[model samples]
Target: MTKEENLEKMRHSTSHVMAEAVQSLFTGVRFGIGPAIEDGFYYDFELARPLTPEDLPAIENKIREIVDADYPFIREEVDKEEARQLFADQPYKLELIDEFPDNRVTIYKQGSFADLCRGPHVASTSEIKAFKLTHIAGAYWRGDERSPMLQRIYGVAFDSEAELEGYLARQAEAMKRDHRKLGKELDIFSIHEEIGPGLVCWHPRGALIRQIIEDFWKAEHIKRGYDIVYTPHIAKLALWKTSGHWDFYRDYLYSPIEVEGQEYILRPMNCLGHILIYNSQLRSYRDLPLRYAELGTVYRYERTGVLHGMARVRGFTQDDAHIFCRPDQIEAEVAGVLKLAQLMMSTFGFNDYELLLSTRPERYVGSIQMWDEATDSLATVLEKLELPYDLDPGEGVFYGPKIDIKLRDALGHAWQGPTIQVDFNLPERFDVCYIGDDGAEHPVVMIHRTVLGSMERFVACLTEHYGGVFPVWLSPLQVVIIPIADRHVDYAQQIKNELEEEAIRSRVDERAERMSWKIREAQLQKIPYMLIVGDKEVESSNVSLRLRSGEDVGMRSLLQVKSLIKAVIEARAQTALEGESI
Candidate 1:
């Protein structure tokens, strides 16, 4: 078997052993589904009482004992009636069985525990060589809020000890770089119970960073021949129905509102609005490929359990754009979007990423000929660009085929970055057309794309990627001036004024705190530069500079420092000084 398949088998079998150990310790505990996740596995249990951290070691010890026994995993195929009798006490299992339409069922048994599962586990418990129980959390059965909450025990298994150790080390680093923890410490953003879950309130610092990102996005789009536009956050519900979103995407949409006896909905996507703008006037073939861009805010209903800090939220602004082009212009427009996406990602220090081509799905719209043509166009772009991509068959959106870009961060973790899709369904449904050379009206092809995905999630990814030590170009507070004593406060203000005149985001720390304390605070805030003003520096008309890395650069003239910062900002450098000493 392949290495990945083997690892999955080992992890799944370890979870079975873990369940056996739990049943041995806690009698009469009902089981829930346990499946292998990205790097680990988790099993849910309905125990009589809540499990604590103290209980983990005992469970781990029991699991080790079971592993030592070298129990073989036996699989059996039974009829529905037999399976029902075997798991009569497990209401969850019975519910799962009832949902299946077939009479045949599969079960896996190891030691004294058995579960109704369709699994390809390892041959025996001894194959689970390296394993560790990580932590516990409360998960609702079947992920539904109305169901009973269960205790989830998470664990990871690997083929070798070294691999497990490396994974553990990365996990430790990830904890330190957790965006939620850093967000609170840096006072960037917050979510309160009163304000509702999945809704973020950006503090001053976070808002400033967002503004900078938005400004950069708009400027780049304008430079690339895109017309920036604004659209309302709500529109008539009939619009969604005509666009087919109400039929396919209604689950994520909020409840409708009655305005003047007509139903309106909070916008869940910006594509429909862009299409409406294209349909506002008749167009000729010369006016084809009109690119419309918007940093539009959208709302979607997400379950509370799945809501994360800013990575997953109910409301967010999408760096969205759509192009309405003729059939012959489809390939060029898609290639142009690919280039723009690459530029944006590389600017953010993401040099390594993966691209995927998703083909037509089972429930796709438009004719077979149209779907084939659109899919061929997307594939041709990837081929012509010589970009390597994976083919995900039957995974495209209902309306079109798409190219998905995933960016890898410093920790070797991947996150969704950009998406480019060629759509024929929307134009057909909305009756968007342009006059062809033959003096006949033909349907316009729509291409929807986004470079940053969403503002909130992108910022969250950036926070963890850089560990909150943003480069000078993107740092909300680029520089902080620290005064040695009350006597030097005037000099520090003068330095701040000079930096501000150059359009640098600088701050003067005029607090009644010691110079060392102020410097430490600035360092903790992860500012790019700290300018120290003292009696000696003021006498010489210079300021001592210290980088966030604690590298001390000797005193330099005020203009020299300003010149250094401006150069970095103008170049949009991704690092503070590029390891240069002033």
Candidate 2:
């Protein structure tokens, strides 16, 4: 076999070894399915007792024993009736056998165990060299919630010990960068059990950071000739029906509530609201390219097992906007939005992104010509920008084609953040129009775009990217004043007041704790700068500025410090403005 084919066979064989190990440890543990994933493999089992971390070692040891035995994996073809009878005790396996209309079926056997799987396993168990079970979780049988629950053991295996060691080290490093832990450690945000899952409660510090981000977004949108707007969170169900969301997306949305005789729903998107705003007024070609921006909050129904911190949540706020333009202007508008998305992402220190342009799906709503036009607009923009992107056939939304941008995180993990989509269905449904150059009414083209796709996911990405050490301009507490002694309190308070007056967030550590303890607290909070006020510095009417790293920059005048911070903020703003133009 070729090297690549051998690796696939080895991965498949490892699954059998894991299954044998599970059967040895847990008697009467019925198996579901074992399959290879991107990096490794996993097996699901319906065990009598819940499996924990302590059970992994015993199971792994059994797998090692099986490997030492060097059991040969033999494949054989069997008739459908014979296969069904052989796997009668295993209902799930029997069901698999029943699904095959053909009489012939492939089965693999090792030692005393046999599985009804298509055979492409390694020659023997000894070839499975390095492996480790990663985690334990509950998975529904066949991914159906109404089905039986199974205990899933997720693990990764490699051909060599060196590869396994490297994988483990990378996993450890990623755990350190997990955003949920960092968010709590930095006191940025929290999700209380009492408040329910998939919902976030932004604390005081986190709220401040969110506000700063929103303000910057508003400023940039205004400069780009985009109008900011807001709408109600709950709307009549008839509005969604008119927009087709009630039919296509009702399952992912919360159940409606009755208000008098009308049913209302908490919106899962802001598109309908923006469409209403457009329908509110008649327009001409002169009013084309009308861009509306909103940091609109939305709620969606998420399965319980899928919720993971801020990345996957039921409630989130999107930095969303919709642009209404003429068909001829679609290319320029799409290019502009792409430039805007790149700017917003790069401003947050994301330089590398994976771009995907998805085409029409099988069940798409628009005409072939409309789909072709929408796809061409995005493609043309990418060509003009000289950007390398992947084209995915039959992967777009039912309404239109889209461009998805996934930002690479610190650990080389990709997070989907930005997206730009074209829509033809909404215009037709809403009957929106504009006066063309010929003075004839024509349907307008609409583009939906979001830079930070969802605020909750964006914050999670930022938390992991910075490792809780946010940049100066984005830091919740930009500076903290730590007075070394009671005598320095007056000067420290005065400096803090001045900074506050200048709209630079500053706080005085007026606690009875020692200066060292106070500084440590500030560091723990990840404050960007710590200003120390001692008697000598107070006498000189200057403050000693200490960075988060503990390096002191002597002493500088109050105005000088203010000017320095102002310059830093201005530089960031300039870079941000440049990034938006891209």
Report the lDDT tens digits of candidate 2 across residue range 237-304. 99899989889998888899998999999999898889889989888999988999999999998889
In the range 1-582, model 1's lDDT, one tens digit per residue, is 899988887888888899999999998899998999878799999999999999999999999999999999999999999999999999999999999889999999999999998989888888888888889999999999799999999998888889899999988887777779888988889999998888899999999889988999999999989999999999999999999999998999999999899999999999888888888999999997899999999999887777878888999888999999888898999999999888888887667789999998999888889888888889999999999999989999998999999865444566677899888788888899999989999999888899988889888888887888876888889999998888999998888888888999999899999988998999889999999989889899999989888899889999989999999998889877876531
Sum up the clashes in candidate 1: 0
Question: TM-score for all predictions?
Answer: 0.86, 0.86
List RMSD in Å for every model shown: 4.1, 4.3
Per-residue error (Å), model 1, residue 187:
2.5
Give lDDT per model, in order.
Answer: 0.89, 0.85
> How far off is residue 71 in model 2, in Å?
4.0
lDDT of 2 at 436: 84
